[model samples]
Target: MRGTAAADRQSRPGRRALVAADLSMLRGPVSGVVVLPNRLVWAPAPAGRFDLDDPFDRLRVYEIVLREAVHEAELRRWLNGAVLVEVWPHLYLPRGVRQAWEAIHPQLAVVPAR
Candidate 1:
């Protein structure tokens, strides 16, 4: 997706805000969820066979994994009804670092992952 189409896709009115508090309210262990203006649908990621050692590297890997999962047209089609929940602590960097990251990538926002 690019230019007008990309903008249109992102600008769609169904977009919803998922705050940190909402994540805490979830009952069970959830990897993530698909979000809409008024609803949240949980969809967990599969567990890996091994654990990651480095924290920074882990976050980068998670971002890449999410991008890969969400980039394809078929996956996007599957995601049509909701927006992906970006888990905090993992996806979120430290406070000062996060501010700097946002300075470079304005579209990025951090929300609590409970």
Candidate 2:
């Protein structure tokens, strides 16, 4: 059952955070996994704080915006300057997770720092 579930998750473009282990993977070295008190969320770069005009500054504010928006308006704002990656999990993940993911991924495509 675990193997089947894992395979299903791997095959799907995105999977819901239904299990603790899967939630852990959501916390793993993968960009854009947002974890709230009760659920896990993931959003592509432009979809969440990753789309902020200034990601380094006002991070908390951006996070608040992400929790509020259920669609792409917020993301669209940042699309011009940000890369459109997979909108996997619908919110921003923790800072450590994002940092770790970036370390391993090393963004092959360069994004000009504002």
Candidate 3:
């Protein structure tokens, strides 16, 4: 998985500016409903209100944060380590975003047993 993700990034012409510096910096809630601010989720769609209890909604929030967040504060505000681990394999992230995160937190690359 790591090899494939890395190869995908290399094939791309330019780097994605959305990649986070590190996952450890995240300090978001592990559960509960969250309404994302407009600044973090504007354009293409309106501000999103997510219910963390629902798997689908949680996935959506994670996807948005990983793709849209521009600052460490935004990342920390919207992401949680435990929740991220649970949803990592299910997240539909860009190659650069996935690779940047999985590179630091290899545990995220380990798919959980079903």
Candidate 4:
């Protein structure tokens, strides 16, 4: 059973290393985890008051976005200048993954009268 589930996990394409130069805003102790269609995102608590766009000033929030692929593609392919949205504090989802993430975990639900 465990093996079957593991089989479904596809490694992302690209170098997993964070470029020493590229500054990241979402950093520090992992505050939350969100699961997407074929990816997993781990985020740390926001260390400062500044937003992602202006990470240069004050403390920065570093986010590590990964693709679920067996052969890693170039780091820029998926995450380069990619738009990101914060679902919850520290928890972020890439623009491309928003709908899919929301589908699995909707903010509002419609349930039959119980």
* Best prediction by lDDT: 3
- Residue 8 of model 2 has an lDDT of 25
Leading candidate by TM-score: 3
Candidate 4 structure, TM-score to reference: 0.22
In order of appearance, the predictions have TM-scores of: 0.24, 0.22, 0.73, 0.22
Arrange candidates, best TM-score first.
Answer: 3, 1, 2, 4
Where does the lowest 10-residue lDDT sum fall in candidate 3?
A: 1-10
Q: Score each candidate by Cα lDDT.
A: 0.30, 0.29, 0.69, 0.28
Better of 1 and 4 by TM-score: 1
Judge candidate 2 against the unseen true structure and give its global Cα lDDT, from 0 to 1: 0.29
RMSD of 2: 13.1
lDDT of 2 by residue, 83-104 (tens): 2223312225543333333333
Residue 96, candidate 2: C-alpha displacement in angstroms: 14
